[model samples]
Target chain A: MKKLSILILILSSAFAYAQTPEEKGLEIAIEADKRDQGFADSSSKMTMTLKNANGDESIRKMRSKTLEVQGDGDKGLTIFDQPADVKGTAFLSFTHVLDADDQWLYLPALKRVKRISSKNKSGPFMGSEFAFEDLSSREVEKFSYLYLKDEAVDGEDAFVIEVRPNYKYSGYTRSVVWISKEKYQPLKIDYYDRKKSLLKTMTVSGYQQYLGQYWRPDVMVMANHQTKKETRLDFADYKFKMGLSERDFNKSSLKRAR
Target chain B: MISKMIKTAVSCALLFGFSQVKAGEWSGYVAAEYRGFTQSKLDAEQFDKSSLSLSFEPEFYHSWNGGDDSFTFVPFARWDEHDPQRSHVDIRELVWLHVAQDWELRVGIDKVFWGVTESQHLVDIINQTDLVENLDGEQKLGQAMLSLSLIKDWGVLDLYVLPGFRERTLPGKDGRFRSIPEVDDHTVYESGAKDKHMDYALRWGQTFDDWDVGISHFYGTSREPRIIPTVTPAGLRLVPYYDIINQTGLDVQATFDEWLWKVEVIHRSGQGETFNAFTGGFEYTFVGVMDTAADFGVIAEYLYDDRGSDPAVAFDNDIFVGGRLAMNDAASSELLFGIISDVNNRTRFYNIEASRRFGDSWVLSLEGRFISAGSMGGPFSSIRKDDVIQLELARHF
Candidate 1:
């Protein structure tokens, strides 16, 4: 009887460890999402530095504003301020979890607002290494997750997750992300192209707490392996919950974005 | 006269003390251009085979009253060595704007654009065409206006009270674009009030997830004048007659992924008859072509007018095909090639434009235009013998 009980115990333990990787990954993603709720709105200024393989560099200044939405993806606006040729240019986006994002660009020279095709979301953002899709708010439902394993990054425990986009037009086939265990924030991400080759790697650092509840990263660096190009974004002046609404993000507001 | 206008503009800028205003911004550009006609001077009619020109445009902006009120002024001037008519000065924009929670008001000389078609801008008529500047009809002269805009969740409504009319600038006798002799500057008006007559316009524009639409109506003097040949003491000249007219226009665009579909239509009752015209087109883009960061786009547009061959402009039945190439490089390099072909006849017009930045503040541009033999006797007859290439270098500050 004791021997039979020991066999049964071993069988039950094996069964408990047999959960699918997909299920485990999804649970971790949901947990991260739950921890990042209730950030109503935020505005920040950023400086972007772009460098080529030859080490040539150019700098750009911009201001960004974002509004967090319930049951939907976020709304964002980025207005360019430096570089005489691109000054007064603005980009506005309305993102969705399961649908293509809507975007518009206001050109100062033409004094007109042009709608950007949704398929262009995968294109480069303002000649930088960061694609438009990468700049957008990452909604949990946009991708299907598969938990890879638990790892330590820079002496901090993190959950390594692999996610495949559910949308058809995404430029990436899959992305592997490392989320810090303590903050549930992405510490690093590796992007794979449609051919399943590693394309780029992004590292997030300089994290600071805002309003005592929300954490924001101050520096983000994206490097493209194929082109040997790099883009570094430094964010400053973060203000949250300043009474922004939907009306502030509409098309007409593009003209007043300055 | 040009120097006087410049002095007045400078005095106004100083009187307002705009430079002293905190947070005010000033920007401008200066450009030099050289044009060489592919055709001989004799074949090009009265136009010079080679010419040089310089131009400058400066703008200033200031905000006060806690950012609720703002002021802007832009003065533009150009000088050409070969064509006197091409050298002129004008105020591009001088406006005082006041913003509220959901509405805004603007009063001054401003420029407005309304259209969706790349081949032709049928609905864009608020500003007079600066014909001497470019054959593409993209350059515009500012007009004095009182505009009020109301913004809402559904869309935006804009009402305009255009108080004065600016006559279109015509090419000089030595200019390359003139189809006929020089147009007389003393413009004739059908209305007794002439240039003083007030014009009004209203437009409502809205955008959805994948669609952008606009509807507009204008009841006022027609910007395109009917040219009447008349003998004057100086010589035989073309007299421009501006007529009163009413026009309704619609523009729509649908964007789906890499494809964009656009349509623009207009119905007008004026001059001698009522007519309808439309332009519809589509643009498809291939991004990251061949695994590079370059983008290539193909565009096709069809233009039609009810007047057919009898129309003054000769766009009765036409098709336009164009290709745009963007390198997506750091210098913002781009090239555009297009051909406008008349389906009813063998007339065809081809143009190419390419530009790239040299450094942080300088840009270089190249342009060329050609016309086929069938273009004779049409609107392009004036330039039947003229094929030209141009180069320009500009510096921004």
Candidate 2:
């Protein structure tokens, strides 16, 4: 009778710990999503620095804006701002289901807009070795998550959650995310491959609040373990609630925009 | 011409296997170019003519390993209008190729050119060259081969055998129209030595962190030297006695940090004579942008005809130095500029070309080639220059 009582007490404590982690992780993920969902009042521009294993580096300036509708799925458009050859080129993302997404690019020389098929979503973009899927939306439903453990991140109490991709076509199979308990923001993420091997790691830093209720990360760094390549994306000058439309995302509109 | 066309069509149809029609698994494109030449003051229309260049390459692939492993075949056809404007269809490469996890094999007629030099000196056994008074052309093709390759973690080794075909010979101006002068008459045309007729070749390659290394060797007859003839030393002969058959060769290439280097050495011995030749060069991309890249290449090559051993063949030594610039855009256009310096006479040959890939169905190209032959040899050998321009369009299905 005494042993049974001890076992029941242990089980209850374990369940309590599990609930705390899931709740903490959901808070961080949801808070970040809410801030990233809105369109900017004006067009925003940012510079990104990508470093490779050989110590080579590339810098890309990008212009991005959000579309009008909140749930229409075609929510964003990004254009390349540097490199004379690929300048004025635009990429559109649509059909943003939790499972699959569609994207396209308009090339100036060919004077044609090409629909990028799903089969090649995992391949490198513009021969830079970064997969197209890496640049897409990371919807919450795209992964199945479970709280792993409690840890200290950036000198703050944090909850670590393991997130596994639910779709077969995803380049990474699993990722471990560390969320700070105080701010409910991601500190670091370790991405895993199909072989269950660690492939890449991403770390977020310098979180800044915008528009009183919204929080934005100043920078995010993604590094490929095997290739020793790294990409640093810097976000700045963020605005909220701008009006954009589907017609603005069309191929013909790419030429007129600055 | 008709027979060559029929053979080429049959070979292409066989290599492609006609499966794309049923499986719906193929995509392709076609290209062509045309050229017209103005006769030099030294040689009239006899050496100059309007020429057309057309090429068709149909590619086919069969998937295996859940589509990871595949068999890819690219068979090409080229038609050129030679002097006197006889149409020639060169079946450049037609082979059945297979690529798996660890093996690659190719059988049938094909061209396997290995080297980093703009002008191949040692490993150019599969093409033929045409010679004019002021132009130097050596192109090799239409040879049958069986090759096997094994892939390793860091490198690959290829072994191959070639049968029935070789290089076309060009004689020195002094030794025109001689029959097997530097080679044996019997071996040149006897046709029964299948044992020695088969050419053996081996190439091994390894890629390093920032460089690639390759070594290859071939034992066979000289593709160019088969006929022989006796000629007097002169400054104005057109067709020289082509001898020096039964040639063996070795080639090497190394690519390092955006730079490519190559070397080739050839030795020929047959029917009482021997000669040695060597060539080397390098290529590198100097300018690379988003949609375009420019490659600058240069070569210093030498060919020694060592007729000093057999006075009967009677020849003079010749050397050449050249450079070429090739610029290409990712989408659909390319431009090439080339210059060759004839060391024997201090003359020069220059060529420029521009080509565009049109839609998915056709391609168009324009080219201009010029050659300046100075007063190098003959009594009437005044400064002669030939300028040629061309435009062509081609389609494929």
Candidate 3:
């Protein structure tokens, strides 16, 4: 009976008269979003390796926590653990679907909290190829989608879709993503700049299932086509359902994020 | 009295008890600095146009009870080659924190920072200034307090009972940055309890959309002192006199895309004259300049003091214009350059700070300050030829 229901779902979604390619794309995105919701909270270790055009590489390590809000977007905190100069510094971000995200930084030396502008969508993250735009949680409502076609990624069947950011201040014009058909996860993405030129490409790999329900990528690498720089992120030590609440993501918590 | 006794006992315990708790974290740095001045010595008691110093700071942190309770210890020490007053030891932060569902309790010594302006921080009154370290007055001596914070959906309200006031450290006559008629060893206070006088403060902070606001009130001994001339056997010396007072402060900051607007205002009564002062500015950033990852910011701020000319206070009737540059590279290099000009006089102060990291454990910093010759009153009147440049390198552990 479960198999039969799954078959019916696929058939109806494929042949629904009101479902144009755009609607199909949105449906696919919504379905993907639904599959990843309700984890409550999670913590992980993140390491980023940045390589410049001359092939010089620098590494940064941080511990991260994420809390999922019911109706709004998620809240995230990252504490720097390496590069001893910034050891105790922390960054806090509250993301929204349409409006600009709110961000704050805690400077350890001064023991001060500074609110920073979040309009730097195309700026580098820690001087890496991954821009701040690439690090925010992708909400389904933040973009308009169009179903392009179906293809295979890493020998797995995938769907190709074109997405344009609905927000006006976005540094990106459009992006094409290849999402796994079976897992409803993104396998790769190609970002376009405001001039509609190819800007960067990100490849995701090392898929691992957490709590036997959620799919997470363990490795993500971004290559900038214009600057000839690259950044690779390695994620590890994933813990889910840590009983995190808004209390743990508040401004007071930012001071002791470590 | 009982609470004070308990605090002393607990501090002794924490000072020695931390070694046994081996599962904690440690971080700090040791630095060596070299300062060179542009002008020669003007007085017989003054040192040469160069100085050297070494500083060390170490921190230890431990948390237990499922991360609900924590303790922190930080000690700072400095050794200056020429000035005895600059060589000292201090407890920068030695505090214990307890986190509850909707509130927090903190005790022991720590530092609290307030205000949001590039030119000056008028509302930051919790910690006394560590003046011997730098002329920018950003370094602070640790303050002992009993603090309680109530965190709610609307905002965070903090109450503090402060004790054990630390006197501001001053450079002596032999020091390079000393004002004429150098500070004497004696200090006078209006409060009968002197340095032991208790103080109180409260602050409520909240955020609305793009705006962040804070309103705070402080009642106690003033952190800033009034300079009084005294005749002594050695010579004419300037004595620091602390007065009982009340101060109210309001600070607001708004972040709008590439533009950040900030303002800090304070009203104080009790010291020489009751007056109001304000400083506000905006920073407009050009992100990704010239198709590079570097960002350049232009900043301008106006400072106003109702009293007009007070020597103890800088930034009175002044205009501050500055620029900040961040080279978004792996090395994390940055630069800040500014000039504060007296609107009514020819007095101008130029400042520059630049820093960059090397590898994972080291950083190099350069700072330069130049006070041009002109008509500025108070302590500024004596330091006309004190232009200096300093370079420092530190290694972290």
Interface C-alpha RMSD after superposing true interface residues, each candidate, one decimal: 1.4, 16.1, 1.1
Higher-lDDT candidate of 1 and 3: 3
Candidate 2: clashing residue pairs, number: 28
Cα-based lDDT at residue A140, candidate 2:
63
What is the C-alpha DockQ of each candidate? 0.53, 0.03, 0.73
The Cα error of candidate 3 at residue B230, in Å, is: 1.2
lDDT of 1 by residue, B204-244 (tens): 99987689999999999999898888887988878999999
Off by over 4 Å in 3: A1-18, B1-20, B376-379
lDDT of 1: 0.85
lDDT of 3 by residue, A1-258 (tens): 999999999898677966789988999999999999989999999999988889988889999999998777799999998788889899999998888889999998999999987877778888788888788888999999999999998798999999999864676899999999988999999999888999999999999998888999999999999989899999999999999888888779998777
Candidate 2, B306-364: lDDT as tens digits:
45334232113334455444443222356666665544554565666666644333556
Could you give candidate 1's per-residue lDDT for residues A106-198 as a string of tens digits? 877656777867676667876888888898888889999999999988888999999998876788999999999888888999999989999
lDDT value, residue B374 of candidate 3: 73
* All candidates: TM-score: 0.93, 0.49, 0.95
Q: lDDT by residue for model 3 over B1-397, one digit each (tens)? A: 2245346536744754555566888999999999998998766798888999999999989988888888888889999999999998888888888899999988888899998898989999999999999999999988888999999987999999998677898998888777776777799999999989999999999999899999999999998888898887977878999999899999999998889999999999998789999999999988888877888999999999888766666767999999999997888899999999988788888999999999878999999999884764544666777789999999988
Question: After superposition, which runs of candidate 1 have C-alpha atoms over 4 Å from their true positions?
Answer: A1-19, B1-23, B42-45, B233-235, B373-375
State in Å the error of residue B221, model 2. Answer: 3.2
